[model samples]
Target: MSTVNPNPSAAMLVIGDEILSGRTRDANMYYLAGELTKLGVDLKEVRVVSDDKNAIVSAVRALSTAYDHVFTSGGIGPTHDDITADCVAEAFGVSIDVRDDARVLLAAHYAARGAEFNAARMRMARIPDTATLIENPVSIAPGFTVQNVHVMAGVPNIFQAMVASVMPTLTGGSPLLSQTYRIDSPESTVAEPLGDLAARYPDLSMGSYPFTQDGAFGTNIVIRGVSGAQVEAAMIELANLFPRG
Candidate 1:
């Protein structure tokens, strides 16, 4: 039998004290997961780190080595605590400084808006040696890529825009397909058969989500796989086993 190759795996590192303190609820991870799914990149892990240098560097090294791609959001800002670029450089053992190309970009952007590209804002231009920039159309300050790690802005819109800039450059595998079947029965009622169905199709992934609607319990069965045929077949079997009321 021919073996099907697995999708490219990815991990996300969300860096900021605000996220851990509950002051900011992160929307970047959710958005990245969906976008990567469409691009056939499997997001296997997520990590949130504070503004601490050791924490950020350690997490970056770990995730970069563990996954095919690592996407980081937050901490590339123009503030004292925004040290993601520095930590990323440390992780890769690379020197980082304000590169001229990035500086020119920021300067022109500020000039057009009649704003001074001051020293504080100039911090945004600092990039690691030999790293490529990820375009940020939303805000002109660009994100950078060093090794397998891609660092982007913490702002939701700019993070999304950077993801858009980065997505087209990576190689992807087969797009995952999924189908959901809603059963007006409790999970306990469907557990045995669902388990059996899952066992029969080891190539596919099946999950049962419990929900309460109008004081009644129900389970939504989702079947996912790389092959559309497999997903559809499993979905049909799932529906047959647990028909809706």
Candidate 2:
């Protein structure tokens, strides 16, 4: 696996009224989370906001400053409600205009179909003046990158392609390593021991996921750490605490 010396932290912004209304489900968050983890970047938070201009602007401003990288999905489409590009520009105190590269790509896409380039279609070409284009293989409407913010498509396929395009250019940190063990015991019996283990390993994250199987309640203990050695050490210590199956 490819790893970096210093890990980066990231956050995602999902902007769409459809998502807020439960009309459309979001698929980008999980995909990005897993991808970033493999790249050694931790996904810190995710926010789902409506298509309101103020909301988008506020989220963009906050996330851009807070995370090493901020990815925004949705609101980059060719419609009046697709105000993400403009909102991002305003948040960054930059201008918004039809970018030549984006326009060329979008124009060619429509022209190939012998379709008219109307105002609706032209909206997709509007990009932040200080941003660079992120190529969209699924569609010609390119995503944009400004500072720490990466604007991408809301559609899963297009968004994923854009992420793939940008990931290669980013700097990553040490990949997190994790281990899971199943214990045929209730959480109440293991909570105190887990707590002690967590306190002993300050650098590791310990979590308990409880479930019921075979008409009995049990908990799955997961330990994660940036260092494989540390995680392995913690697993050994945890196993010693509960030697029997």
Candidate 3:
């Protein structure tokens, strides 16, 4: 038995000038996309913005309103460039400062490591007034949830940790299931028949990917939908249309 929900939509905002400048490659978006899918949350859009206050605030406002959830990665750190927390507060027109709850957690962790909670490091404790803290197992610095937005770290490991912390609380929908068919012929030869099959199964999504295997070219066709029975039936019809060798 499984819990079923109709639609749980989400958007992701990747905030970093480094990403746009090609100084750092983004992994959080890809990772979150996969994780959200398994949790039955449909990731609708992804936006990449620089470390600017106005830009981050604008993106947060738009995404938070458009989708049921908005996940953001990057810019909540102990550096001057990290402006995500303040921007999120501005988006909701709320106050932000170093909260005692966050400071206590960070202070204890730093003391254990024999590191000083200096001016810059204390920046991690700067959380929005009304936000709830998201536990960060990798680093003592916590992420947070301000309203519908989940502000996470840029580092893949910590971002993943924050995601794990937040996922259990979200309402997920029906799991999305998929089926695949392999055609021995080239993609061009397979396109027409594939289109016809896709037309027949309007409830499902059909995708044909051209791949080169051992110096030979072929297409891998995938059919995906929420209904396993429908997907299985479609796979059978696909095999019949383009008999496998």
Candidate 2: segments with Cα more than 4 A from true spot: 1-6
Task: Put down candidate 1 lDDT per residue, 1-245, tens digits, no spaces.
Answer: 12254999999999998999999999999999999989889898999989999999999999999999999999999999999999999999999999998999999999999998999899999999989999999989999999899999999999999999999999988877878888898899989999898888888888889999999999898888898888788888887776665
- On TM-score, the candidate that comes out on top is 1
Please report how far candidate 1 places residue 10 from its true position, in Å: 0.2
lDDT values of the candidates? 0.92, 0.90, 0.91
Give the per-residue lDDT digits (tens) of candidate 2, residues 1-245.
Answer: 12233678999999998888989888899999999989899998999999999999999899989999999999898878899999999999999999888899989999999999999889999998979999998987999999999999999999999999999989998888889988889999999999988988888888999999989999899988788998899899989988766
Q: Lowest-scoring 10 consecutive residues by lDDT in candidate 2?
A: 1-10
| RMSD to native, candidate 2 | 3.0
TM-score per candidate: 0.97, 0.94, 0.95
Shift in Å, residue 197, candidate 1: 0.2
Residue 93 miss distance in model 1 (angstroms): 0.3
Candidate 3 RMSD to the correct structure? 3.1
Candidates 1 and 2 compared by TM-score, better number: 1
Reference-based lDDT, residue 140, model 3: 71
Cα misplacement distance, residue 179 of candidate 1 (Å): 0.7
lDDT (Cα) of model 1: 0.92
Clashes of each: 0, 1, 0
Model 2 local distance difference test score: 0.90
Best by lDDT: 1
